[model samples]
Target: MDTMRDRFAPVMTELLDEDPRVAVVLAEIGRDGLAEAARRHPDRVINVGIREQLLIGAGAGLALTGLRPVLHTFGSFLVERPFEQVKLDLGHQDAGAVLVSGLGSYDWPAGGFTHMAPGDVALLDTLDGWTVHVPGHPDEAEALLRHAVAAGDDKVYVRLSVQTNAEARPVDGARFLTVRSGGSGVVVAVGPMLDPVLDATGGLDVTVLHATTVRPFDGEALRRATGAAGADVVLVEPYLAGTSTAAANDALADVPHRILGLGVARRELRRYGTMEEHIAAHGLDPHGLRRRITRFLDGAARGGS
Candidate 1:
């Protein structure tokens, strides 16, 4: 729905009004939608029209001057095109910002690969000090947004889109909240993957853990939850498959473990269609995920490679 728009506009405006240290940088998007906030604050809400590099550069400059800049745009334009700027401008300068992106994964399938960014999170993982968040619901988004903005000196990237869970779950900056408990395995659902993960594990005896704040992943919590059975872990993410494989390994170190990673396909479909179509092809839909997870769990139980 309008969760993407509403999350940016109203919450941003409120943050701007309450915090003088906050500023906005737009890459030709959300400029007019926040016109009044720009008018009210004059120099804070900047519309850097289409120049993605300059948009990030400007945000870095603002941060250097003791202002917390919140940059907004679609995922590809915000992170991919201007990635060098994101690295050199903010990272090199040792600056921090809240880079909030809209239209995640294939949210804008009509716009083609140029508009979609399934690798943004993986890219951010390369850098230091970034806290990536993929909110599953509007409430989770708002809470995470407020927390990121208030943090001021933290480097945060929030991916917002139309995909959402049916309801909200308890959220924190660096902890995985358990949604269901069972002995067979643990299904870690990141962001909107909660719905599909839940559906896939419905009949299976497993533990389900939810996470909106993914990066700096809740490794400690993960260890504790899976300690008893040392059960299987099925990480279902909304971005690239196995992006957090290494982190999962580190978290489960010192114990024998197995993990099945599910996410957006690394290979492109090479055809444009609806989000549902793309999801089905990638085996991310509930039914598709269920089949894959079921087979994996069964094979693992049988001691098959």
Candidate 2:
């Protein structure tokens, strides 16, 4: 099985090859992978060095000139550093450039707090006309890349994980993945945490909905799922609680929801570690999640009893 980066690189290369007008923009470390893709498909790649601000600006400029640019970089640099350019040049103009943000949510341990960006979803979601997608697996990343490229007139931000899992399937847009079937409750997972949620639920009638795309949430689907299960929906994410999960709950106001947000307190910097370690430290691991879900269900049952 190919790593998420390996699978995505080739698909992206193919997409660029298939479309003559599409240009690939590579930033710093992400440029290494893009370089390999460029070597295979030379005409479509553009190397922009380490300047994230300039990279996004160039991508936006290229888009204005009838070229579809796929800006690639780490999530933190892409969203935080070049936000002004993304907001003004991309969002304001509706440039339609595909912003591929890789290594999302504490992917690089040594990169430290300066590189850990948990708010990319929040920032991108707030932007009008921008589609924010967080693919759980490489297959979904590939599919969503194609969809974003074909979308033509809308800005797209795709959050990609560094590590790949065997369970990650190819999917498009904001569609959710049903990980378990049960009558107890619905556990909505965002990002790579879907695997753990499944493990925690075991034999319970807990249905896990893996939300690959955070923005433009599937409200109707959520309502249908919750209604069908006859249980409260619990949203799990690796960022601050008030952003994606809260917004999603608001979108489906008819359904009751509980949001579990995981991140540094007050956005403070913590010890650097892998994504799993970070999640575990914040009580976002499988055991913690299981306890919370069980407690929620038990409390709900008690109220009824």
Candidate 3:
């Protein structure tokens, strides 16, 4: 199976090929991959050196000239280093550009924390008019990209990862993916962690929600899903506890949510390893999550309160 990165590049290439107006701005590292596509389809890609700020600014400029610009770069560099440029050039101008941010979270293990962007959601979510999409799989990424390209108004930030895909049921709307069916409680999982959630809840009557879109969430659908699973809800995310999930819990005040998060001790990681190792180290492995969910289900069953 192709990784999300491998799958996404081709879809983007196809889109650029079919549409003459669509042009790609490839960062230094991404240039080779995108350049090959450009070569095959000539007239679609613009290679920019390793300048994050300039890359976005130029992309915004391209959008102003009636061209669709898709900017590609490392997630950390795109959001962290080019903060001002992205905010002023892209967000402020309401530039219709798609930012493909690669290696979200610890995807770039060898790149270290400096290259890891676990806070892209919190950072970009604050910007007005910017749509932050954290897709769980390649299919969702392709679908979301198609939607964003056709949108033609808002700025888009796609936080992509090399993580393996979860077996999520195809999403029909902008709502989250409901993994396990239940009428007792809801567990809202962020990103690819939905796979682990399903593994954890083997025979339990708990509903698992995979949140594909982090911003501009489908409130009506969320309410319906949580309501269907009763009032008890638990939010699971790889990010810090008080970020998106916390804010969402506050917004849905009527439904009580138990925010289960990665403990504070594992917040700023120092070592390098695979995603599985990191997840295990932080007690997010299937066994650990199973124990937690079992406890929650047992408690809910005992009182039915």
Name the best candidate (by lDDT).
Answer: 1
Those runs of model 3 whose alpha carbons end farther than 4 Å from true positions after fitting are 40-44, 166-168, 228-230, 255-258, 261-266, 294-305
TM-score of each: 0.98, 0.89, 0.88
State how far residue 289 of model 3 sits from its true place (Å).
2.3
Question: What is the lDDT for 202 in model 1?
Answer: 92
Report the lDDT tens digits of candidate 2 across residue range 69-101: 888887889988899998998888878798887
What would the TM-score be for candidate 3 when compared with the true structure?
0.88
lDDT of 1 by residue, 162-253 (tens): 88889988887678889999877778999988998898889899889998888888888788778945768888988899988789888998
Better of 1 and 2 by lDDT: 1
Tell me the RMSD of model 2 versus the true structure. 2.7
Arrange candidates by TM-score, descending: 1, 2, 3
**Residue pairs in candidate 1 whose N, alpha carbon or C atoms collide under 3 angstroms:** none
Better of 1 and 3 by TM-score: 1
TM-score: which candidate is best? 1
TM-score of 2: 0.89
| Stretches of model 2 off by over 4 angstroms after superposition | 36-43, 228-230, 255-269
- Give the clash total for candidate 3: 0
lDDT at 117, model 3: 77
Clashing pairs in 3: none
